[model samples]
Target: MNGRWAVGLVAGSGTPSERIAAELRRRIVAGELALGARVPSTRRITREWGVAMATATKVLNRLRDEGLVRAVPGVGTVVAGKPAPAAGRSREPQRVSPRASQRMAERMPEQAPEPASRREARPEAESTGARRVRAGGERDLTRERIVATALRVADQEGLTALSMRRVATDLGVATMSLYRHVPGKDDLLRLMMDVAFGEQPLPEPPASDWREGLETVARVQWRIYRRHPWLASTMSFTRPVLAPDAALHTERSIAVLAGRGLSWEEMAQASVALAAFVCGLAVHFEREAQAEQDSGLSAEEWMDRVEGEDHERLTADPERFPMFDAMNRGPEIDLGLEALFEFGMARMLDGIGLLIEQRGGEGGGLARGSANK
Candidate 1:
């Protein structure tokens, strides 16, 4: 406990309560405090650490704030299970095989130079084929190839670098050839979004449970946006493309929620709310991903920069933002999408749950009246 407390103490410094909270946070992250382990009570922590009750409260609050602890009805604050690891971090590192290394060596360029005659002849041979193709190549280009090349370019350099000319050049075709496939940039974008969204497998209609169905659709959409970071901005809420795959997803979502006894209006409103939550989250995540890709800054690095800027702003105008200053004094405030989504989802579900219960009670009362009649 002393060694652990020492590590915690060193990590905790700055604000008295924050230091205490940090130490506790370290324990949780370090796996020293296993998930579901009962953290010491406020009074016990105060006495054990020789800190005030206020300090202990702050420490617990910080842990709860970070989703590391939960308070059950009868149980005091208890540690929460570790959140699922971020995508792609849980897998083992891929190792190249010895056979692949041997294959690579076999394909390596020769060190010796080719004969002068062969070198001179190679260009002539290639030029003959190029000239023949140039005369007859106009008819060989197709819409599929253009779209396929455009997708490849987007996959490599991102959607921002994609253009008709770029796709045509990649395919060794004229830019006008692409017009047969896509009318313009906007048309290409619509087609591209449809293609990407189509990649998401729609769940079977009439899911066994509403929550399971909603979660499935939400997770699928989330993964799509995660892979295609540009999809968030490209997708339109008001005028979503009525692609078959997209329509199937919408149909499945509605079918699942149909059993909830909600009126058509209520069901539609709830569906919109859920979709908005998922889209908002995807947009936020994509923005962060793009920022990281462009700036080469990790999340922690971005947080550091933000905190530094906030500190400077606070010092420059203490009188203007008293509440912000007070909040800044506490643990690092994370107003990230993860937190926002969790808060919104919990409240939204709670409201829905209450509605369902009330509907059930009303239905039950009507049943009793009918039985009496």
Candidate 2:
């Protein structure tokens, strides 16, 4: 890795991440950036290097992967101890002494707590209670790490269990420190939603068949909701999260319907309808997860305990509900969410197909004759 960095730097040619990582690496090895001192954060890196957030994230990730730096909750990313002396180099720079390192760390400016009056002036800031400093001395913390940790917490524990304190506890940082990067829980949730939606990217050149494209979009959302069961609850149909990546899903849906012999209104409704169906069905996922967690029983087990009594009650009046009794006696139905999602998606697409056909049949020489061809 050192050899690669040397060559890349000397040649002045490499990916943005490589060049940036090399620069940071040089600072760490030279002891220009002292051990345990906070390194430039992702935001700082973006500002200093003028790189995109994605590229900045990659640079930090590469540094992390190489073990040159580590993220300290509340403090941000800092140099991970001092780099070891290179082998067989008599001229190698001497490692900074512990005393000198301590002095350097002390010389680094600390971030004082924000004043209460100042915090109160921010309209969106919610009171997260009195802040507590981390037990251990401050380590480096970063917004990227905070968001990633918050995402994990939401995924495992569900959103209701999430809070600024919850994330701070998980990060081993003071609750107030998070406010520096994320203003409040609302902003944190938005960042989490953005990261989640950006996980899957749209296909280049897109699918030629509108049906295929729409199906792809629906399935992608289903998979995303399945992975983050709590994601469905965060979404709003009317007042959606201001996440650009999430909006791309809607764009893709509408793009496929372009020139499909439908009015602008019809196209817009079709896109929204597809999203509504997916979100409506997906709500069950988080609810079921929470139910299982709280009740300590899987859906099947919960149903098993109740089904016997319910079945008997319904079957007792067999003549009144003959078909219901017979069907229950026959095969066990797969009413699982995954099964329902598939059934709903197929049926929804069928409805959309009918709408397209109906629009084609309307008077005034067809809205777009190309749809039939």
In terms of lDDT, the best-performing candidate is: 2
TM accuracy, model 2: 0.60
Mark the 10 consecutive residues where model 1 has the least summed lDDT. 123-132
| 110-228: candidate 2 lDDT, tens digit per residue | 32222346333322212342334545513667888889988876775466546786577556577877888899999999999889888977777878777778889998888888788
Q: What is the lDDT of candidate 1?
A: 0.59
Worst 10 residues of 2 by lDDT: 361-370
Off by over 4 Å in 1: 1-144, 155-158, 315-323, 358-373
What's the lDDT for candidate 2? 0.70
Query: Looking at candidate 1, what is the lDDT of residue 199?
Result: 82
The TM-score that candidate 1 achieves is 0.54
lDDT of 1 at 258: 76
Question: Which pairs clash inside model 2?
Answer: 72-140, 75-141, 76-140, 76-141, 77-140, 77-141
